[model samples]
Structures are given as structure tokens and as C-alpha cells.
Target: MTLRDFALMVVVCLIWASSNVVSKYVVSHLGVPPLFFAGVRFVLVALATAPWLMPAPKPLWRILAVGVLMGAGNFALLFIGLKTATPSSAAIVSQIGAPLTAVMSFLMLGETMNRRRIFGVSLTALGVILVMWDPRGFHASMGLLFVLAAAFLGSLGAVMMKQMDGVKPLQFQAWVGFSSAVPLLIASALFEPGAIEPAAAAGWRFAAAVGFSAIVVSVAAHTAYYGLIQRYEANLVSPLTLMTPLFTIGMGVLFMHDPFGPRMALGTIVALAGVLIVALRFNQLVSLVLAMRPRAQ
Candidate 1:
């Protein structure tokens, strides 16, 4: 990758990480209902990518399912989780998606995981246990369950994503936007009475959060990240993107004042290492270790 590509990758990571902090503020601090916020954000995304909605592409039902599972189920749960969960912890827990995707791929697509990936799954489970080892008990931390559910739904979306064809970048966003928005809007209305007026009057920070998420993170950052994926090997791209959780932790602490303890620190290290293992191809990983070894004289 060139310096420009590296910089773009950094920008994408930063945007994604920062969006978590912003979402926490919007949903929790501002007291805007979580599903409502998600609905409005998707509205912005839908408008911005409206042109892509025109074509009735092949595998239309799959596209709609992917959109609902990913854009709606994933974000709705994540936003609800953020209401109680810290951004830093949410970021780490959400990474369970990688392992979940591996499992889904194996079952649905008949893909096989190597021994390294199996080890990676074990490591990820250990890391999660460490991270969630609150003396108070994890059952009370229902927020973690919500995030994990989101990760599972997202993994399903990824598996279904493999089935679709001829979907462009903006078009994918279009499907996600439309499919997620309507359901979330209905949910918000059914559950959150008198929400709209307060949210509308919440002023600029709320609007700013929505804009940053819909335009910056969902649109600009995703486009750049996807471009990098197109250009680079998946193994290389996946590991580098791990910077997102680290960046999220940093933003959470610095901006959102989220706590970071010893267990969380260790868990972050272990989980990220496991994800790296899962992401890299077995042969590529072995080659990387060999290359890094000291050369004989």
C-alpha cells in the first residue's frame, strides 16, 4: 500500500471508532431513543444513496435480508447496548463477528476453517470471558448480550452477502438504508411515544452525531475501506482494520470518559490477536513468521 492508502485506512478507522463515542452521546446522553436515532440516521443514508435504489437487482430478497440483518438488526442492538454499555467494551465485544462469520461460513457456505482458525475461536472465547468477568456478574450486563446478538446477526449478514451479485457500493447502502429505516421507524413509534419532539429540539450535537454517522462513517469511511479491500489481500486488510477497536477504546476514554481496567486491557490484547489469526490465511501466516525470523549468515 502507498502512503495515501495507509492514511485513508487510518481515516476510516478513526471515523468508525469516533462514531461509537458519538452514538453513545446521541442515544444515552441526549436521551434520544436508540431505535429512533438509528431510524433517522438511516433516513439520511437512504436519501444520500437514493439513486442506487432504482434498479431491481437479481437476488433481491437476499439483498433485503442482508440489509435488515446487518443494517437494522446490527445497529439497533448496538445502539440499545450502548445505552448501558461502555463504548470501549462494546467495541471489543462486537469483534465476535469475525469468529461468528467463520462459523456461519462453514455451516452455510461449506467453507472450512484450518487449525489456526479453530485456535483463534478458542482464544476469542477466552478473551471475551476475561473482558466480561465483572465481579457483579454478566447477567446484569444485558447490554453485552445485545452487542453479541448484533454480532451474530451481522455474521449472518456477511454469509448472506456472499450470495448476492452485481450490487454496487452505494446500492448496497441504499438497500441497507431503506430496509433498516422503515422497521426502526415503526419500532420507535410503537415503543417511544413523544420521542420525536424532544429529539428534534435536542439541537446541533444530535444532528452532528447523525450526520457524522450517516455521512462520514457509513458513506465516506466505508467506501474508502471497501476500496482498500478491493486493492489488498483480505488477510492484510483484516488485521490492519483491528486498529478500529483500539482507536475506539482511546476515543471512549478520552472523549466519553469510559473506564479501562486491567481485565479489559488484557482482553483487548488477546481478542485482537485471535482475530488476526482468524483473518490471515494459514499459508500466509506461516510465511509471515518465516519472513520475520532472523536470516542465517
Candidate 2:
């Protein structure tokens, strides 16, 4: 990667990482309803990216569908989890999406999963199970289950995105911003009456959090991620995304003061290790590492 790519990746990682802290605050501090906040955030994102939607080509519909999974289902479930689960735990649980996606692709798309990927999926699933079982310092086991549901939806979206075409990354983000708003609004209306009034009452802090989510995190960070995919191989970009949860864990501890108990830590490590193993092709992984090693003078 060039310097610019490297810098962009760093920025994306930070923005995505901060999402956990911001989300925790929005749910815990501002008392915003999760589905309501997701709807509002995407509405802001749609407005922010409205110019791109006018042309609305046919290819965009599939993209929009994928966005609904990512933006609406993934986030709605995540927000539900956040209402009861801690930021750190949510981050760890949500990562199950990666391995889940791999397994789904193998089953649905007729893609083959080698031994390494299979092992990786098993480890990651076990890790998630461990984390779910512990619930040590965190509250709401049911909430964690909701977050896992969100991760599954996200994995489905990821798989769908692979089959999609003609949509740029930014365009994808914009459509998601647009499509995600509808379901979220519907859910909010049904489940979270008086949602907007409370958000308005909460004032700019709430607004700012929503704005950052829409503009900075959803729009900018995702744009960079798609951009990276354009520049590098999918395998390379995919593994690096692991950094996102790691960063989220850090932000949760430092910014949100989420407690990191032994169980959570161990679970995270085990889960991440599983994901890493699955993500990297064993022979290719060895070659890549050897290539990266410094040579003797």
C-alpha cells in the first residue's frame, strides 16, 4: 500500500473503532432508542449523500438491498444489544459475522472452505459461545444474543455484496443510508414512541453523535474501506478489518470505561485467533509472513 492508502486505512479504523464508544454513549447516556437512533442516523446519512441517489440506476437496488442488511438489520440488532450489553462485549460478539460469512459462502455459494477456514470458523464460534456464556461483568445475556443476530445479518449482507455489481463503494453507502432509514423508522414508530421528541430534547450532543455516525463513520469510513478493496486484494483488506473490533475494544475500555474482565479478554483473544486462522490461507499465510520478515544483513 502507498502512503495515502496506509493513511486512509488508519483513518477508517479509527472512525469505525470510535463507533462503539459513540454508540455506547448514545444508548446509555442520551437514552436514545436503538432502532430510533439507527433510523435517524441513516436519515442524516441519506440527506448528506442525497445528490448521488437521484439517478437511481437499476443496479442500485441490489446495492440498496445489501445496505438494508448492513445498515438496517445489522445496526438495529446491534443497537438492541447495546441497550443491554457493554461496548466491549458487543464488539467481540459482533465479530462472529466474519467467520459466519465464510461458512455461509461455503454452503450457499458452493465455495469451498479449506481446513484452515473451517477450523477458523469453529474457533471463532466457540469464542463467541464462550463470551456469551461468561456475561461476567456485563448485563443482559439476551442483549448479547440480539447482537449475535445482528452479526449474522451483517454476514449475510457481506455475502450478498460479493455478488453485487456496478455500485461504487460510496454509492453503496449512500443507498444503504437511504434504504436503512425506512425499516428503522417503522420499527421506531412501533416500538419507541416519542423517539424524536426525546432526541430533540437531548440537544446537540445527541445530534452530534448521530451526525458523526452518519457522516463520519458510515459515509467516510465505509467509503475508505471500499476504496481499499479497490486498491488491494480482498483477502488483504478482509483481515485488516479485524483491526476494527480490536480498536473498538480499546475505545470501549479507555473512552467508555467498559470493564474488561478475564473472561471477556480470553474470549476475545480466542475468537480473534479463530478468525485470523480462518481468514488467512495457511500456505499463503506462511509465505506472506516469511516475505515480511527482515533478512540478515
Residue 50, candidate 1: Cα error in Å is: 0.6
Task: Compose the digit string of candidate 1's lDDT tens values, residues 124-218.
Answer: 87887677668888776688778889999999998999888777788888989989999999999999887787688888878888999999989
Which candidate wins on TM-score?
Answer: 1
Question: In model 1, what is the error at residue 78, expressed in angstroms?
Answer: 0.2
Off by over 4 Å in 1: 286-297
lDDT of 2 at 166: 75
CA RMSD of all predictions: 2.2, 2.4
- Give the CA lDDT, 0 to 100, for residue 90 in model 2: 86
